[model samples]
Target: MQVTESGADLLALLRELDDPQWLEWPTSYDRSAVAARFGELVARLEGDFGVPCVAEQDTQDSSEYGRATVPAEATVCGTRIVVCVSKFGSLALVCAENPGAYLGTQDAQEEGELDDADLASVERALVELGFTVVPEELVESDYDGPSRAHLYGQRPTWWDRFFGTF
Candidate 1:
């Protein structure tokens, strides 16, 4: 089946597979079923939009105090579109014009970071999402980090507004 390229269409496809009534077993115990459903969606997207879609299972093991990470599927059109599934199953799509470019590899053992193919895929996905792809130099801008002191030349109070104090 062909899927529409719009975000709304993608969201609708996700909802259909994620719906509780379509499954033969409980979702908690049916991991393969979930993967299959996602794969089907990806296939449809590829067929309809000529975009590549790939899913990676999230790692479960982590340090005791480590932050929880979402499971992600990387879709490539003109830029990289990362669709991450939160613990609660809600989805968020983040587009990076240069995927894995600035960031180093997660594995310390790995020799290098993301290569050109990775960046190309990211660029493709971003374009599929209707973003205009431009050279980094054209859009580059600098912003300083938040200031430590309050705007009135004093430290912020507990009730002080965040951005206002900065």
Candidate 2:
């Protein structure tokens, strides 16, 4: 009916990290479908965790005109969890208590990025909700083929390697 200690633990971990970190749902599904699941999660956050959750359209050109967008983030126990859906429907995650952006690897480890416990709790909660957590970037084989840059023999920067990757 509502979230559990695991959810609160995740919120604590998010607060402790204080820097952006990444999480991935291995399975790619339509954003509309996932948004429903997100709604359930938001309900749990408010009903069980006592956190005020918010949902809003991302307002990014990359986002769809009027569908497939949700709050994409929330803060609980003083930490924040940000959820982002790709144009192609994959879910990418980042959490922080402070204001900034992290791309999973650009920042050094000394900055208090999320620890394993933090990742585990959030990942466990997601797994219970029917999503497989991928640790990092999806392999090239996960896609249909090499990207346009690779296909055309143009070497794109490592940062530009993946499609819909932030």
Candidate 3:
């Protein structure tokens, strides 16, 4: 969803999706697993970029639980960036113009000298680490989130939506 989306928009979307039971906290959600993945991701990022990794979580948000948004940040190519990650395995790289500006729930906010090639390398690292990195062009120019309709003649599941896998 867009960073500009309102709370009402989120509610509408959830209701439209029939209030997916899996979204309920402590149901299908595994907090420990999510946290562990975050740690691993941070380590991977640090190694890939040759920089220290720092992460910020969302445990204080009252309206947020069961969901993941472990954004790990670091400096690469002399530019600070935040790698937004989620439990669903979606990731986005944001130039760290503002601290904590990027999260797994929203689009990226960027303001650095990270050229396309640099961003591509970052995406490659994420993909190598087994995270689904959406093409920046599609996300920046044509993102509509995931479709519930038969995308490419197949009904989309959460797996397909986030991981590009069946």
Candidate 4:
């Protein structure tokens, strides 16, 4: 069956079934496994629909989940669908302008430098995909324990104290 860009229909289809019933979830499903799953899904979708579906894996460490973007083609609707599947069966699909657009927005958001237009576009895309996109002000609220652990080691003790003050 071919999947269309109608958010409601897509959501219904996804909610009606489970992926685990068809594919085995690896115990140690790391980034590689996620990428492989993305590739597999794209291949299946393309074969079933007989269209060109390009799948690209986002390997950035800061992302909450691994991402795969499939562009729309002649047979498919003009939608750029981003699939993010967690190791535990949880999956989210965010439809945006395109992979390049979404990634650019993400990069700006991560850097806390997103312009108003870009931010609006991102919000619109997320909302269209039925997601409650968090505001930038509230995005970094949860900071505790290992979740906030600095990937890079601390500078000087003085710099550490001055870090948040700025």
Highest lDDT model number = 3
Residue-wise C-alpha lDDT for candidate 2, range 36-122, written one tens digit per residue: 766654554454334465544332433211111112243222235443323232223334332134434113113555444444445
For model 1, the stretches where C-alpha displacement exceeds 4 angstroms are: 1-29, 62-77, 90-94, 97-166
Residue-wise C-alpha lDDT for candidate 1, range 37-127, written one tens digit per residue = 4455455445544556555543242100011111123322233334322222222222242223432222211323323444444334434
In order, the Cα lDDT scores of the candidates are: 0.31, 0.35, 0.41, 0.38
TM-score of each: 0.29, 0.43, 0.46, 0.35
Model 2 spans with C-alpha error above 4 angstroms: 1-32, 45-49, 57-79, 87-90, 97-100, 103-110, 113-118, 136-166
**lDDT string, candidate 3, 31-127, tens digits:** 6766666667677666766666667644332212122222334333354555555433233333433323433213342433344454555556666
List the candidate 4 regions with Cα displacement exceeding 4 Å: 1-28, 64-66, 75-77, 86-90, 98-166
On TM-score, who's better, 1 or 3?
A: 3
Question: Could you tell which candidate, 1 or 4, scores higher by TM-score?
Answer: 4
Tens-place lDDT digits, model 4, residues 41-144: 55654554456665544533323344445444422334444444333333433334433343443454454433444334334443444443322222222322
Point out the higher-scoring one by lDDT: 2 or 3: 3
Clashes of 3: 0
In terms of TM-score, which candidate is stronger, 2 or 4?
A: 2
Q: Number of clashes in model 1?
A: 11
> For model 3, where is the 10-residue window of minimal lDDT?
61-70
Taking all chains together, the TM-score of candidate 2 against the true structure is 0.43
